[model samples]
Target: MHAIALTDGLPILDARSLVDVDLPQPQPGPHDVLVEVRAASVNPVDVKQRAASPTLRSPRVLGFDGAGVVRAVGDGVTLFAPGDEVWWAGQLDRQGSDADLQLVDERIIGAKPLSLGFAQAAALPLTTITAWESLFDKLALTDVSHGALLVMGATGGVGSILLQLVRELLPGVRTVATASSDDKREWVRSLGAAATANHHGDLVGDVLSAEPEGVDWIFSAHSAGRAADFARVLKPFGAVVSIDSARELDLDALKPKSLSWHWEYMFTRPVQRTPDMVKQHELLDAVAGLVDSGRVTSTVQTVLHGWDAATFREAHWLVETGRTVGKVVVER
Candidate 1:
């Protein structure tokens, strides 16, 4: 199997930083399934991982979200068969989805949404998992009868799905979306945001102008370093869920308002080998059901040809630029 890998360069941003390698097809563990990867999608984590840890041992394949047909199943795998079309986000500690063949635990896999193609399905798992877990599991926000929800980076992959998920799951809640460009603001508006704000300037004023009472929930999908930025716009006793990395956050700033903030990492379940690891699979299936029922739509905005390092570099570049409206995918 041919795979794209990070072989050299300290902060790799191009094909020179990655290479093509031929490796034997990976065999599955007792509870794993071997997938013939048809298409794969890029995420912000891929960009972050490739540029970190300067020294590469031999080579490291990079990808997490993939959609493909099951080519083989381990003896202990019962949920998926050899011919089932599935979509999943692979474990972070193992080889990734940037290969012709990849092995993933059956417990974390789900049947692909029937309404979407392979490329479209590939774009959903990772971001959908993050968004679903952030809003529902981590924050425990299934109902929006209380107040509005604000998403930071509203045009990104996770935010795009987050906006729609909130609309479908909580029809009565108002939504405030923030984007950097006019096109992005319009995109989120189409996704059913009650209002859109420019992340670049006067975001709080814009949000307040849209919702005078203040937002009840804030989901920061992008840079989450600043606290004062949204403090005035958020209601007292509000809650926040952030998925992005933050180097510095003043937790004390929320004391006066008694605001509660939570951080969500989508890989935590599989990474920690938790007892509820299978929840990811179930949640993914639920998301698929939502997609199939016409309550959700694919967020893939750019689809490139051939799953190779060159094509992946383009996707990585787009993600790093922080300007892409939605997910980018490539087919093998």
Candidate 2:
């Protein structure tokens, strides 16, 4: 099997950072499925791992979001068969999907959306999982009918899906998103945001001017520094959910408003090997249904072919640049 592997921790711009290597095909565990790699998407996590994480004894394969056909299943795997098409954001600790074949736990895999191609399906798993878990699971804003919900960084991968999910699930709720450019603002509106503001300008003042009473929920997908400003714009007793990691937060600033803070990490379940790991499969199934019904669209913006070292390096560089509108996919 051919794989892209990183033997050293280096910048993505270096062509030799990721190199093509031939390795024996991986064997599945009791609850695993061996998938023939069809397509995969690059995420910020991949860039971070390549640039920061320490080099390992064995070359590390780096990719998380993927869609492909199952070529084999372990003895205890019953969710899929050899010919079933599936999609998933594989676990962080495991060898990732940037190879000819990769093994993933069947509990985290879902059937691919019938309406989308392999590349399209590959774009949804990581972003969808993050948005779903952040809004519904962590924030507990499932019944947001009479108030407003604010989403920061609304044009990125998770933010794009988050806007659509909020529209579908909370129809009556008002949505305010933050984007820098008119094009991005229009894109968020197309996804059903009621209002869009500039993240570079005064977010608190802009949102306050739109809704004098402040919003009910805030989902911050950008820097944690934005949380303090978000706290200022949130109503008393409201909640704020953040996915970015910051050095420090002034928890005291949230005291006057009685605000609650929640951190959302979509990889928590899979990384910790939690008891409810199968819930990811369930969520992906719902997401697939939504996509198949035309209620949700694939966030894939660019596609790169061939799962080689050069291609992986290019994909990492694109993600590192932080200008991609949506997901970037690579197909084998």
Candidate 3:
């Protein structure tokens, strides 16, 4: 099997940061499926993992979002079989989807959207799961009749899909999203956001101007240095959910409003071996149905046409630029 791997947590600028390597084929464990990867997408988690550790005794593969076909399955796997097309964000604790073949638990894998190609489907799983969990799971937003929600970093991967889900699931809710420019604002609107705020300008004021009473919920893609802004724009008793790590957030700011804070890590179910881990598969299938119905669209902004080390490295560079509109996918 061929894979792009890292032996050290070097900067992307270093030539040795990511390298092409040949590895033995991986075999499936109980409940696992061996997938032949056709396409994968780069996320911030991949970048963070590459730069988090100084050195590794063994090569570490680092792609999470992928679309592929199952070549084999563990004896216990009942959800899928050899020759089944699948998509998923593989567990963080396991070898990721960067390899030509990866062993992923069938519980986390979903049928790929039939309406989409491999690259388009590859760009969705991680972001879709994160966004879906943030809204329906963490926020318990399945029944709200009418309210305003704000999404920070709305043009990014997770935020892009999140807006679409809001439109599809909670039609009564109005969404206010944060975008830095005119183009990004329009882009977010196309995905179903009712309003846009400039993250660079007065974010609190911008959101407040859209909804006079403040938003009912805030979904933040990047929460660093924006806790105060989030606190100011959320109504009393409103909740805020974030996917990024925030070490120095002032919990006190949210105290006055009785605001609740939550962290939505999509890997929680697979990493913790939660009893409901199969929810990922269910949500993914639901999203695929929406895609097939033409109610949603793939968020792939840029596609790298290859399945090699150089292409993967270039995908990382695009994601690291912090200005990518949606996702950067690499496909064969």
Candidate 4:
């Protein structure tokens, strides 16, 4: 198998940091499926990993989200078989989906959406699962009919799909999407946001201006450096959800109002081998149906080809720019 691997754990640049390596084919475990990589997407997680220098004895493979065909399945796998089209955002503890073949747990895999090609379907799983868990599972937004949600970083992948889910799943809920510029704001609107806020400006004020009452929920896909500010604007009993890196967050600010803080890590279930790990399969299945029915769509902004190290590096550079309108995908 040909893979883009971290040859050395040094400061990683784009192409210079990643190297193509040949490795023996990986076999599936008792509950795993071996996927022949077809299409993959770059994520902020990739950039974060590349920016660091982790000591490793072997070249580390590093891609998180992918869509491909199942070449083989383990003895315990029953949800899929060889020749099945599947997509999944794999666990963080193992080799990722960035090569000719990768092994993933079938419990976290879902049938690809019939309406989309490999590249398009690859862009949704990771972001969709993250946003879905954040909104519904973590934030307790089971019924937000009369509520409002302020989404930080609304022009990005998870934010884009999240806004659409808010529209389709909670039609009556008001959405205030946060973007950095006018064009990005317009892009957010296209995804069904009810209003827009400038994260670069007075975020809380902008959201407040859109809705007189404080927002009922905050789905932050970016830094919540102003956690206190957001806390101040959230309705007393409202909650906040985030998936970004931890910082010196003033969690005490949320204590006064009895507000809560929730974190959503899409990899938690798979990494920890949670009993309900199959929930990822169910969520992906639901989203795939929505995609096929035209209720939801992919957020792939930039597309590349050649499934090689050079191409992966270029895609990473685009994502690191932090201004990409949506997800960036690369296909073989």
Candidate 5:
């Protein structure tokens, strides 16, 4: 099997950061499926891992989002067969999808949407899981009746699908998405945002302008320096769900408003092998239906055409730029 791997935790500009190598084909575990990876997408996790500490004893493949075909399945795998097409986010502890073949647990994998190509399907799994978990599992958006939802950093992969999900599923709740520019605001608006705010400007003012009162829920994609803004813009007893890391958050700021903050990490279920791990598969299947029905769409912004080191380096470079509208995929 051919694979592109990171030799050490180095910058993407380094020539040895990502390199092509040949490895033995991986075999399936008792509950795993061996997938022939057709396409893969790069995410922030990949970039972070590639540049993180602890240089590896050997190269580690670093892709998380993949759409592929099952070439073989273990005896315990009931959800898919050898010929089934599948999509999934590979577990962090395992070798990733940046290879010709990968072994993934069937519990977290779903049937790829029939309406989409491999590249399109590959662009969704990781972001879709994050967005779905952030809204339904963390914030409990479905239970809220009539309130405003703020989607901070609304031009990224998760925000792209999240806006559509809220619009299609929660009809009563309006959304205010944040973008830094005119074109980005328009892009998020096209994805179903009721209103758009510029993240570079006064975020609280922008959101409050759209909703006279404070918002009921906040989905923080990039939450590093916005803790004070979150405290100010959320209504009393409102909740916030974040997916990023923050070094300095003033917890005292939330006391006055009785604001609750929650962190969402999509890899928890698979990493812990939780009893409800299969929920990821179920939600992904449901999202696939949404895609097939045209309620949701793929967030692939740039599809780089190749399966080599240079291609992946370019993908990482684009993602590291932090200006991409949605996802960047690598297809064969």
Candidate 6:
């Protein structure tokens, strides 16, 4: 099988940061499925891992989001068969989907949406999982009847899907989004945002101008530093959920309003091998159902060809630039 891997963590500019290599085709474990990867997508995790993680004794595969057909399944894998098409964000600690073939736990896999192609399907899993878990699981904001919901960095991968899901799942809930560009503002509006603000300017004022009373929920899909700004716009006793990590946060700012802060890391379940790992599969299934029902749409913005290191690096660069409006995919 052909694979793109990193023998050492280095700057992506270095040609050796990622290399193309040939390895034996991976076989599935008792509860695993060997997928013939048809397409893959890059996330900030890939860029961070490549730049910061130390060199590994073994060359590390570096992609997480993928969609493909099942080539084989382990003896205990009954959920899917050899010919089934599936999409999943593989476990963070394991070899990823940046190869011709990849192995993933059956419990974390889901049937791909019937309406989308491999590249389109590949763009959803990682971002959708993050957004779904952040909003519904960790923050527990399934019922939005109380007030409006604010989505920061609303034009990014997670934000795009998150916006649509909020609209579908929380009907009649007022939704606000922040997008710096005119195009992005229009995009979020199409996704059902009640209002759109500029993240580049005063986010607090921007959101407040739209909803003078303040919002009920804040989902920061961008930086945690934006949490302070989000806190200002949040109604009393409202909650804030963030997927990004920040070095410094003024927790005191949220105290006066009695605001609660929660951080979500979608990979935590798979990284820790948690007891509820199967929930990821269930969540993906729900997302697929939404897509099938036309309630949700793929966030894939740019699709590149080939699964080579060069292509992967280009995708990484686009994401790292912080300007990509949606997910960038790579097809085989």
Tens-place lDDT digits, model 5, residues 1-332: 99999888778989888999999998888999999999999999999888884677887988999999999999898999988999999899899999999999998999999999999999999999999999899988774467999998799999998999998888888999999988898889998899988888888788889988889999988888788888888999999999988888777888898899999999999999999999999999999999999999999989999999999999999999999999999999
**Candidate 6 CA-lDDT value:** 0.88
- Tell me the tens digit of each residue's lDDT in model 6 across 30-145: 99999999999999888888888787788888899999999999999989999999999997778998999999999889999999999999999999999999878866865646
TM-score of each model, paired residue for residue: 0.97, 0.97, 0.98, 0.97, 0.98, 0.96
What digit string (tens of lDDT, one per residue) describes model 2 on residues 1-332?
Answer: 99999888887777768989888999999999999989999999888888886767888888999999999999999899999999999988899999989999998999999999999999999999999998889777666467888888788899999999988887767889998888888889999899987878988888988788999988887755666787788899998888887777767778889999898888899889999999999999999999999999998889998779988888888888988888899987
What's the alpha carbon RMSD for model 3?
0.9
Q: Residue-wise lDDT of candidate 1 within 1-332, one digit each (tens)? A: 99998876544554577678998889988989999999999998998888774767788888999999999999998899999999999989999999999999998999999999999999989989899988888668756465788899789899999999988897767889997777887899999898988878888888999999899989997555458876778889998899888887777777788888889898898889899999999989999999999999999999988777888888788888877888989887
- What TM-score quantifies how close candidate 5 is to the native fold? 0.98
Model 6 CA lDDT for position 139: 69
215-286, model 4: which lDDT tens digit per residue? 988888775577887787799988889888767777888888888888889999999999999999999999
The Cα error of candidate 4 at residue 208, in Å, is: 0.8
- What is the alpha-carbon lDDT of model 2 when measured against the actual structure? 0.88
Error of 2 at 239 (Å): 1.0
Span of 10 residues, lowest total lDDT, candidate 2: 138-147
Please estimate how well model 3 matches the true structure, expressed as its whole-model Cα lDDT.
0.92
Evaluate residue 6 in candidate 4 and report its C-alpha lDDT on the 0 to 100 scale. 70
- Better model by TM-score, 3 or 4? 3
Better of 5 and 6 by TM-score: 5
Model 5 residue 75 CA deviation (Å) reads: 0.9
Q: Output the lDDT of residue 15, model 3.
A: 79
**What TM-score does structure 6 among the candidates reach?**
0.96
Enumerate residue pairs that collide in model 2: none
Better of 2 and 5 by lDDT: 5
lDDT (Cα, 0-100) at 200 in candidate 6: 79
Better of 1 and 5 by lDDT: 5
Per-residue C-alpha lDDT of model 3 across residues 305-330, encoded as one tens digit per residue = 97778888888888898989999999
Candidate 2 wrongly placed segments (more than 4 Å): none
